[model samples]
Target chain A: MKTDWKFILQIFLSFLKIGPATFGGGYAMIPMIEREVVDKKKWIRNKDVTEIFAIAESVPGAIAINSATFIGYRLAGVRGAVAAMVGVLLPTFIIVVILSMLFLIVKDNPHIESAFIAIRATIVALIVYAAYKIGMTAVYDKTTLGIATVTTAILFFLHVHPVVVIISGIFTGMVAVQIKSWFGMSIKLEKDELNVVKKEKQVKEA
Target chain B: MDVLVELFLTFLMIGFVSFGGGYAMIPVIEIEVSNHGWMTTQEFTDVIAIAGMSPGPIATNSAIFVGYKTAELPGAIVSALAMVIPSLLIILIIATFFFRFNENKFVKSAFYGLRPIITGLIVYAAIKFAITNNVIGELSWHTASLMIIFGLSLFSLIKLRLHPLFVIALSGFVGMVLY
Candidate 1:
């Protein structure tokens, strides 16, 4: 594929807008990403976002970065992927670097330290909230809930590395489906995407 | 240069292994960062918090932070690049080999289990952060306050249904004011 700079730049600019606009990280940028990618830019189909979420989440890294790369690659080959990746990361990089630098200067200040003290506590709540929100959709059945419970126990109690946990999850998911099939049950994977993933906040891949 | 290479390799390892969003990488990151004497557990929490409050992914944000601490702007730049390199390579390989593996039954079934495990991974991250940050280790006035804030944040997100951005922003405000 010939590297088209113009389209690559467009992809970059599109995600540049998305990077700094998102907050609270994780899947928080899904709706905004959809707006830039599928709705406004017309770069991809509506349903592809769900598939992208699965692929991005199944592998290592952030959903935001993974989807950016995946969509970028889909749009304009490797150039497109690079454009989108840089686009998405550039704004956040600049902002975070500035923040981190500023934090270095003020981290030990009594006031800011106190603020971080509380902020840290609230962050725990935020992560837990993420779990709760995603769990609502993910653990819809006993099998799924069982997977979640066992996984949680292992990660928490054993302090197992998350990569290992993720691998186990994939294995368990496949096995769970196979076991169900033994009893003549089948997993309807894609038919229900619209209902579960169509919403803004609920479509999180985290 | 030595430190930069270390930073690159360390985060490269993290980027490759991370799954279920950057939150799941917390434990892995903590160990690596501490082992390298980059930061203490307490300091890493600060990185996690900033990463959370910022836009983009936590893994990327952490890379930036660690990079900055090591070598300023250039260090930050390299670390950021290093963080995404593994995923970039993986995706490129996927694009080459399985351009459209989304419809594969084996993959779909794997995700069936993965979705909930991600949920669990995230929950584990939260609990670990709480313990590391001293929010849950010992119960006292400080822990009590932390619990109250945690409850309020949860309520705002779940019941009141506030957006995460607002919840985090509000938490920062309350943190500055109360704590």
Candidate 2:
């Protein structure tokens, strides 16, 4: 695909707006990204949008950047990737640079301190809201709830590292699936087993 | 050996270690910034606010903020790139290979399990941020009062589809007036 500079410019501006204005993190950017990219610009289809999101989450990078890179690469290949990355990052770079300068000048200023006090309180509320939104989707069943509750308890009480909990959760989930299969409750597992056995029989006959 | 290399490597390590995104990166960033005498605890809090107000992931914002503080425009570019590189490499690799195993049962189960764990980590992050910012704190009359406000605001924000920015602004107003 030929890289379109005009399209790249539009994307850059959109991301600049999103970067400066978005309150939370990656998840919070979704609605805005959808509004700008899918609904307004028609840069990608709905399924493509969903796939980008899934890819962003499963991968190890910042979700926003990954999504941008995917969408950019899809639209215009390497140049698009570069454009999107630069677009999303530019606003933050500018804002942070300015703030860093101002902070040095006012390191001991009383009003700046008060302003931060107020902002921090507000940020706390925003983070709580983000948690609630994610929880609604994630904690749907008893087993999932149990994992969340236990993970939270360990984090709060034991000061356990979150990565440890994440690893354990994956293990527990695998065990849960195994148990479900053992009890003949997993149709997917049964089907997989049946396919494997059929393949084994075919090989033996040949 | 140079200050720029030190700054770049610091951000690279921060990006590499931080999982579950922005909130998860806080402690690591704090350690790095403090260790290098780049920023103080209170100053770090301010940087977080700036990052929160801005966009493109908190870690990147912090890197930009910290880098610019240490050096200048060059510092900002280096730090931001360093923070992003690790994640970008991982994402690109995963994107290449993820589709081949899209329907694998174990992979599906693993992701399914990861959902709840990620949720828990996110929730814990919120609570920890609240506590660290002194939004909620050790039990006291003031703490209890703020907790009530917090709960009500949280409920309203969730149930009513209120714009979070507005809610955050309102809470800021309340803090300004009361605290």
Candidate 3:
């Protein structure tokens, strides 16, 4: 592929367009990214989308920015990666910075503090809602449900590292798989209807 | 300068541990931010509310908010970079050698366990915040309004299929009106 500033700019602008719509997390933007890069711009093939998405998930940042960087690197090397990352995150960066400033100013006011009091309670509901959203996919079978229950109990009571809970969750999955196969149990772990590629398994894991 | 560096380092560590995604990072974030005295647990929940309402991954949004609260725009930039730089480096390295990394069983197994634990973690955060933030202590008429807002928020999110950002915005409006 030809490497040029214009091409990098195209990549950057394309991702900038995708960034704002990526609410709820980065993975939701995969189809949009795929359309822009593969169908529209022809920067990479359909297959590379899945590959980049997985690499994005396995890495440490927002999958949206990471995947944008991967596609950018594929096109124009390090400079392209930087451009795409900046483009993808720029909208969010601007919004959050502005909100932070506003929050600092308003948070101390009596009216706003009173509002936050209500917002705080509602936020608890939202957090529970998050757990409900994740639970639908995570609890596939009785075994997995047990794991979630135990993990919740241990986390609530012990206050140990979440890293341990995660590691143990994997071990529980492996053990459950082993038991099912060994005993010929018909139970199978079906993930949420979401495709693995766009989903966190390949997309949203932060 | 020191605050920016500390913010950078803290979020950098958080970035790696956030494999299960945004909500999964809340507990770890609570630990770090509270331990540093950067924010109280209740204030940390406020950050979550802001991050939830904003666009982007919650972790990244949290990084920006934490950065700004600690030291302004420069702090925001450094912490955001720290939160994401690890992903950039790791992905760049992988782009060179591994084409099909998720095929590994160990990684798969770890994620399998990770999913439920991630759910558990978020749930735990909810309960903890509920208690610490005084969601249930006094049970006054004021608390009733809070519970009503909670019901609406949950229903909008879980059943009505409202966008989270929209629900948050609406809740804020309602809070202003009622409280």
In model 3, the runs with Cα more than 4 Å from the true position are A1-5, A167-206
- Going through the candidates in order, their DockQ values are 0.65, 0.47, 0.65
Candidate number of the best TM-score: 3
Better of 1 and 2 by DockQ: 1
Candidate 1, residues B1-179, lDDT tens digits: the string is 49988988888888877765676677678778888999987888888777776787887898899889878998899889988988899899887786566567897787788888888888777877888877786778888888888889888888998876677678777888987
Residue A156 displacement in candidate 1 (angstroms): 3.3
Q: Rank order by TM-score, top first?
A: 3, 1, 2
**Pairs with backbone N, CA or C atoms under 3 Å apart (clashes), candidate 2:** A19-B55
Worst 10 residues of 1 chain A by lDDT: A190-199
In model 1, the Cα lDDT at residue A2 comes to: 68
TM-score of 2: 0.74
Tens-digit lDDT string for candidate 2 (B76-97): 8899999877766665555556
Name the top lDDT candidate: 1
* Candidate 3 DockQ, CA atoms: 0.65
Show pairs that collide, candidate 3: A169-B113, A170-B113, A200-A204, A206-B21
Can you give the lDDT of residue A62 in candidate 1? 79
lDDT of 2 by residue, A26-66 (tens): 66666677677887889898667766765665555577877
Candidate 3 displacement at residue B159 in angstroms? 1.0
